[model samples]
Target: MGIHIIKMPDIGEGIAEVELVEWHVQPGDTVVEDQVLADVMTDKATVQVPSPVDGKVQALGGKVGEVMAVGSELIRLEVDGPGNAAAGAKQKRPVERTETAAQAEDATAPAPVQERGADAHVATPGPAQVPIKGQAGQVQPAQSQPQVQPAAGAGHAAARPAGEKPLASPAVRKRAWDLGIELQYVPGTGGGGQITHNDLDSYLARGAMGSAAAGRAAGYAPRDDEQAVSVIGLRRKIAEKMQESKRRIPHFTYVEEVDVTELDALRARLNAQWGAERGKLTILPLLARAMVLALRDFPQINARYDDEAGVVTRYGAVHLGIAAQTESGLMVPVLRHAETLDLWACAAEIARLADAARAGRAAREELSGSTITLTSLGALGGVVSTPVINHPEVAIVGVNRMVERPVILGGAVVARKMMNLSSSFDHRVVDGMHAAEFIQTIRGYLECPAMLFVE
Candidate 1:
């Protein structure tokens, strides 16, 4: 048998360290070539580490949630012939171990114990035979005691005999007291009718912990369960990004309601005329068109801010980012050059990007380089929202749920489709008046509908 060592490879973009997100193999498990050994996370991207040679896993390099540096040992395997451990010994030298690590290693090492036969001594649910800590911090097994079998018909815990004194150990008595169980009502399964821990467990497991609790409604039963989930991988990156955006930038939000009855009618007309030849249209593509034309007048809203360099770069081409909710989390996939595509083309590209993002197939390039962002919650969109600007970007526009309500027009009540635009901008770069004006310009294109087609 030969030893093979695999080191963490450098994923590009000058990343020096990556967090170990998941492991596909454990020690003693045989793995084949090209099999994924582990999953590591760098920034928001996840990369899989594959085994180059078939081997049995000897040891894992790190635990999940550990941030390990590039070139660190990832795994050790046992292969058939001479392995790379000997050839690359100098290049992949073992890391220096600290005193704490040595002690931890020794503490987890299994101690030698003799195996017992089935007919020998059987372990009971009591303090006896349980391991206890000695004065030297060493574990010592408690002395064994005599064992007794429960009655053949002891499936249900029967009440003790009327005049016979109930028998039990001090430990069992204390546990019964804690559970508010009376010893006289419990049946003993030990010698001389002594109640054992197993009897108490059986009573609880049979849904009869106590008469009063059993009679209570199941919906109101007391529960003592909890779960702890570790925040790692893409979730951690999102948390960090949101925190950075909130901490560094001063955000100001503006909201405006628009009458979209004419816009919806226009969309229906176009979809009806071209539904067979071209793709159907959604409000998103029309909104994208409105934003594109509006940006021509309000160029300041479509820009990125470099706080460290104290520079703001505005782009002529609108690379719009559409926020998408995926199975994993929130992701923003960019639609390059939204100003060039018509309504149908824009809708097709938006759907394609959204599908790619949801399926976890969005490329890194497709996820970045957006001048501004647009976010919508579809039918779940509520009255209004205060959306956070994507970090380094000046603004983000949000769409709310559209509803038809009564409105007074021409001194008469009429129903109109209305929606609200909730948008936020960096207060350092954009003034309140300009922010409101930008949304008003987009609202103009949307409310009029015909203006979107004009030059």
Candidate 2:
């Protein structure tokens, strides 16, 4: 067998490094050509690394969450015939130390001494050691182990005398304490009468600890489990972007209530009429049209701000950003040339871009270069929100949920479908008065739905 090495490829945009997000294959896993071996993150997008040649994975260069530089070794594989790597070259990969592996031997050790009827037997605790896999793929015990006390349920002793401390590892003790379990009264089943994790589980499972335990058996068990998820990939990118936006820009938010009763009615009528010939329309397309028309009077809102250069660019063409929530995280996909598209066309493009973003299939160009962003939580949109401006963009308009509420219209209590527009702007570029005027303009078009089609 020959050795093959796969190095991290440079994922364009002059990026010097990428964070290792996920691994599709591990050592001993057989991978076929064109199969994705790993996923690495560059900025916000995830790029998959596919295997070029069919081979068995020998070793991984780095663990997940490790930021690897370009051209660094990613994975090592063994294939037939002479591979690209030298036959006798030593592969240098970081060894991973897992919590389970550190406690593996302790979990497997023999139980402690016990008294049987009239006779008593003494069981000695073995030396603490951890097993580590050697380069030769052999298991070797490492010397000078970290100090470890026996875990819970250590001994098979039927009963221990009162005031005698129960033998359990620190982890087990902490877990028991969290569960309000008194270890002294509990029996140990581990080596030398030590308490183990299993003993605690079995104890809880059997409902041995009276009323509170019985309540747990009846479905009120208190849990102390925690998961440590590393912030990487798209989530990391979002955090950084949000932090930068908040830190670098002075932000001001404006909110206005709009009577969208006519707008909703118009939408329903359009769907009813075009139900068979064209796709159904959502409230988004109308809003997009309104914003597009409104930008004519308020050019400052449809622009990008270069804070470092002290330049506020005003765009004649409306490039709208549709904020979408994906399985990975929040992503904003750009809807280019919004000024040119009508309501139906805008709806189609919005749906397409949202689908592409959610599926992680959106191209880089489709994700960037938005002049202004429109975000909505749809049915979940609450009464009010303080949206943050998309970095370098002067404004972001947020759509909130619409609800029917009683309103006094010409001395009559009329039920009106009212919605709120929550928008944010970079205070450094767009003034607060202009931001308010911008939202009011959209409101006028929305309340008077026919004006959306006005030339």
Q: All candidates: CA RMSD in angstroms?
A: 11.0, 9.2
Summed over model 1, clashes come to 0
Q: Give the alpha carbon lDDT tens digit for every residue of 231-327 in model 1.
A: 6766677788889999988999999999999999998999899977898999999999999999999899899999999999999999999999986
| Model 1 stretches with alpha carbons more than 4 Å out | 87-215
Against the reference, the lDDT scores of all candidates come to: 0.77, 0.78
Pairs of residues clashing in candidate 1 = none
lDDT of 2: 0.78
Worst 10 residues of 2 by lDDT: 116-125
